[model samples]
Target: MTCSRMQSVVIPRHFDYRVLKCKVSSISVWNHLSVHRSLAMNVRRLEVLDERAAGSGMGTGDQTKEMVPGGISSTETDLEDTDDELGMHEKHEQYLLDALSKMSHLESFAWSCNHSPISIDLLWPMLLKCHTLREVEINDNLVFSPVTNDESEGDSPNVAVAHELRAVALKSNKHVYGSAKHPDFTRVKGMLNSCPNLESLNIAYTQPRSLPHAHLSADDLFLFGRWPNLTSLTLTNLRCSPSTGLDAASSFLFAHLNLEILHLDMSPGTATWYNKLVFPPNCLPRLRELKAHRDLVSSLLACPSDAPRPLEIIKGVRLTQATDLQQSADAFFFNLRRHGVNVKRVELTSWHEMEDIRRLIESTPKLTWLDLGKKGNGNHHDRLGGSGASSSGAAAKSSSSSSSSHFSVVNANEWAILLSAAPELTTFHGVKFFYEVSLQAQASIANAANLPLYANGSTGNSNSGTGPAPGATAHVNLNLMNLSMTDRSRIRKNDETASMLAWKCTKLRRVDHWEDGGGKVVVIIRDCGDGKEKDKVAPRWEIRRVKQ
Candidate 1:
């Protein structure tokens, strides 16, 4: 009898298979399909009882055989436990390993492992084998053994790792750069010259101490300048003096013109060095984005002032500190407008008071996105009281620190002024803690400027119009993540300042405020149509509360 015929011999579902296996311990089929020492031991026991019933002439063979889902016979069911199936299982595991190995191409593999020590030798072979390796992020107190070449006795990790990765991000280390015993920038330069396709480099440390200017010979540039495709470069807190290998890197741009992004987050003291030097014409004509955190905006802009075109294609700009706020503001905007660049977006890290904010907004008329907020307290008391308190000698001496700390708050108000200036602005993101007087006055100013306001809602759901007016979407976008105000009781309804805020921002879509227990309450005002549904209908604004 075949196994298929046995299925037609109806049996109880709860029949114990182990009892029958115990009775027929001497069976050959039971020995072949042993139940012991296997992961599927219980499955094997069921098969043994099944075979015993078939052997006992449960039914006739061949005609009434059962066909499995894969159309495999009982003969093939036995093949499932054979060596061929094991081979297929092994092949599947290898296929998975190959897929995981290729993931290093798009991502930084070094950062992927958070709490495991990476095997350098194991990885070196895989990296050498894998063609898709692009970025290697070895940070977070990682201790790696020095890389050794095949044929060198005194080989100090022959810098072969550079040939594999396009970009290397190294951070949080004891040494100034990546290596513990001081990194020779020449070794890195040599590695870069060897790799035909290397693009970006990121390194940040406690100090900027590597490579003496005297040691960086002219041969360095001759070797390094071979890379015509090199574009983006970033160096943070690197002790690169005027004489050091800085010229070797800069010379590449002067000779060939394919650089795009340059991020220099250098030490505060070394920032002023760039202002003194000048570059050749068309050195960096392809340059579009620049991020300089320490230097005064005026000095950095002075570097590319004489170029055939002064960064007309430039899109993004970030400045940490601006010297002589009013003067710096004027110079920065004038250069962009002069070039007809039309700076669409801007982020101001430091600006204090309503006057500075107003000046910036009025100057940059085409700004669409702005991230302007307070860094220091503005001497509002000084402005409100007519500068008389600071005019006194004794008061000036006692309030020097307080006065400086007070400037950041005033700087934050400058953002509101800029918003008023650029009525075309669509998105304003950042912490806003300006005084009520300035906010109200600026709101009125913005309203008079013809800036249309839309509440935070889906354009499809908007009853005001079919959708947002073409250029009006950029004006206001509030961050509603983890709101702090939940209940109307927590907000002082009768307070003079609170009342002013409520009335001033009549065009507001959302309002977030603080409540008890550090929770949030969000008030969403939607534009539901009034009783009349005319084209020019004044949409009703209904405020709904969202409790924490």
Candidate 2:
């Protein structure tokens, strides 16, 4: 049976041994038992979870015995009990090894022991035996030792033995309130060296913990270069040593031509203390997307020229300082245009000015998606032209006036000018449109439709309609295809915008509006008519609102 099929088959109690063995092709045996022997041997993918409860069990049986519930125990009695517990622990480890040895065709293995730290020495031998293994995950404060006996040995045994391994995840299972104990860096490096064709590696905290030493060192960054085929790498809370310069770090990362996606989180501290990354030209040739801290992005944008490879997407944490943010924003777009980078998607925490938005629109003509909002609630307060106070004043003025108002800081005229610059724009978030602008857009559409038709029945001269004026090009193709906004003004719940869209914005298909009371309304437009007989009957427009 396939792995997915095997997962869904629930075994009922009271089945015969033959029947049970036949149907039970895969099992996750938490503990070593005689009843699971037959089932365990047939299992191809196994996940051995830690049996330790939150505050309960100690690591080994001996350690468990040392922590007696009673106040104080005699040393002689405790020593005797410890020896007895140690013998039982040795037996238990042997039993586990013996059981794992039966699974000759095991493909995947995962072990998590947060409360009870498992010794890597006990698990390595059994893992080495599984030549078919492709993925391995070990978490929960597991202690690791070098796979080889010689400390001076250049290569480890696991890398040489696990030929089929493609993915490895090593993490701590520390509770939110507890301190994190990271796995040995040397052991982790050895594992990477073993899997030359490794594609994905994730080493991060399983929960929030306050342990600075647990962070990966700057020198460890070079270990990633060993895996030439690595496609995805995720590292959280990485620490940079004073000796390691940002230039070296950037150069090492740029050397990885095969890397496509990277997620990085620097150690939490003052941004100024962090070394600025210096990316040279033609770096990250195959990198299509990057998600990192603002400091890292700022350093990248500081590069003298455009990136050697075309970056399509960038997502990063927002900078809080106003001056630092403005400089970063300016540097980012300026470098993008100067380098001729063809980035089409962006997600930023904030944009301070309308000019910045305008310049961004002009720089990336192919941009199709944009998100400008705070991290949690997606509320955007930054204005296009003014400071926070000025933006509030603009909003107040907009609310009182019917003919003009500011939506997310852009006035009606400014919105038209800004939007007109982006030819391929679509899927915008956190930008509302004033009612007056909607009406104006509708009027432009009506004017375009009223223009004289040619003798052959095709659209006339581009400059014929009042919408285009004397020499200006008509913007009939400018459609807000997918719009996401919050209606703070709370205009009347009429079909004014919908009607304008039907008449002018022919290509607009969806609009998501957030109402005042934390409710959402999604408007979808569908054409419900056959393609044939265009002249005989007008096309039908169906507008529907789904409330959330």
Candidate 3:
């Protein structure tokens, strides 16, 4: 690449680096990465996961590196040929340290292991070298320090603490259903002590479960000093310590005045436990996004905040009881209206009727993305993008009116008519897009766009509204529709949907098509004509799959 090209090369802040054992003369990922020294200097986040990288694992063979003195190597060698991996691990650690030391702009560093938890002694040199590093994440059973016998107090080694670091995420070695048996308090405390400038803390399981039972507790949190900079907090799988545990946690949350985002997915009877959850006066003044179990959503938002904190996202838990889809949606809309919250993105788990869905849209008109909760949900999506007989005239309804007994099968034209009120909407989910091109559907879309419909894109009389709108264009902004039915998500025929709505919704950029074995295919609606040829300018459609 040329110097100009190299200068303009955009390096992603988040980088996932994996070390693989290759047979090409011990050439490592580091060897290739080191060539672009500029890339290393600008890295903000990095992950190292390999068979024997750093503290991931140290082999247990009798072949120790021939020592000069105090088991120190005068000259470091690569680990490809060494089975005496303890001494061999030093070389890998040296390679890691050398690379980390050069990342002056690095902010976040993540490390993982494939097996058991190990001592993080190997990470000390790395952490010490990264001056601007603000975050550290480890998936290994990476312990802080060994525990002692004393019940009240115990002796744990004085580990190096990065006062400049702002975030630390610790995940279990295992990622199955029992992801969080929960690490010990002493170990958590040791970690807390190591990174005292705590701002954002995320200790949650990596998977989904009905309930998560953890040994970690609220009392353990009180062991550390209050972080004044703490803004975002996520606690997924933990039981209340006891009678006073949840109370202490409540107090802890209330005390943090700067908190903005909070996800309290407390488990093992998650929802019912937080029914009585309370917030102190004027607490969470800057709070914006709140996610928790559905049962706890109402109670959580019931306690009014002194400030007018406009929440942009509220993700209540997935609904296990399908019977209350209507009641549940009504309650959610009530909160949005009562709290005066205007959200941009919504993920409605389970399902709800069309009327309930309409109420939600009216409540949050600024919605840019809406997930109708996935298909195979309580109310299944139309495999044929079902437009029932009642929904046939759905396109004729006013943008502000409710449906006329339409049960299912909302076509592209109906969606265009319904979502026309929210011009900012782009990515829509939950509903299937089974809209096949037809005269009625085309006419409806054209009406929604404030343009006259045309038959077969041919210019005709401008007297009737159904005739071509002489030089008019679509006013619609809807684009990037996502269907929940994976089997029927793909839009066929060079996007017959895009072509039909082209006169009405000109800005429709891309739609998602998911084939079970294939990755995501994006429909690109590009304007290939020049401004000089305004009359000739038309949208060109292209399809490409996003690499997984």
- TM-scores vs. true structure, each candidate: 0.48, 0.59, 0.61
TM-score of predicted model 2? 0.59
Candidate 1 lDDT, 91-191, residue by residue in tens = 33333234334333322344322222333333434444445556655442222222345523433454344354576554434333223343334433433
Cα lDDT listed for each candidate: 0.37, 0.49, 0.51
Clashing pairs in 2: 159-194, 282-308, 306-339, 354-384
Q: Give the TM-score of candidate 1.
A: 0.48
> What's each prediction's clash count?
31, 4, 2
Off by over 4 Å in 2: 1-44, 49-99, 143-160, 173-184, 206-215, 223-225, 245-248, 270-275, 298-308, 317-321, 349-358, 375-421, 430-523, 530-548
Regarding TM-score, does 1 or 3 come out ahead? 3
Cα lDDT for residue 459, candidate 2: 22
Ranking by lDDT: 3, 2, 1
For each of the candidates, the C-alpha root-mean-square deviation to the true structure, in angstroms, is: 18.8, 13.7, 11.5
lDDT for position 150 in model 3: 60
Q: What's the lDDT for candidate 2?
A: 0.49
Choose the strongest candidate by TM-score.
3
When 1 and 2 are scored with TM-score, the better candidate is 2
Predicted structure 3, TM vs. truth: 0.61
Q: Who wins the lDDT comparison?
A: 3
Error of model 3, residue 513, in angstroms: 2.7
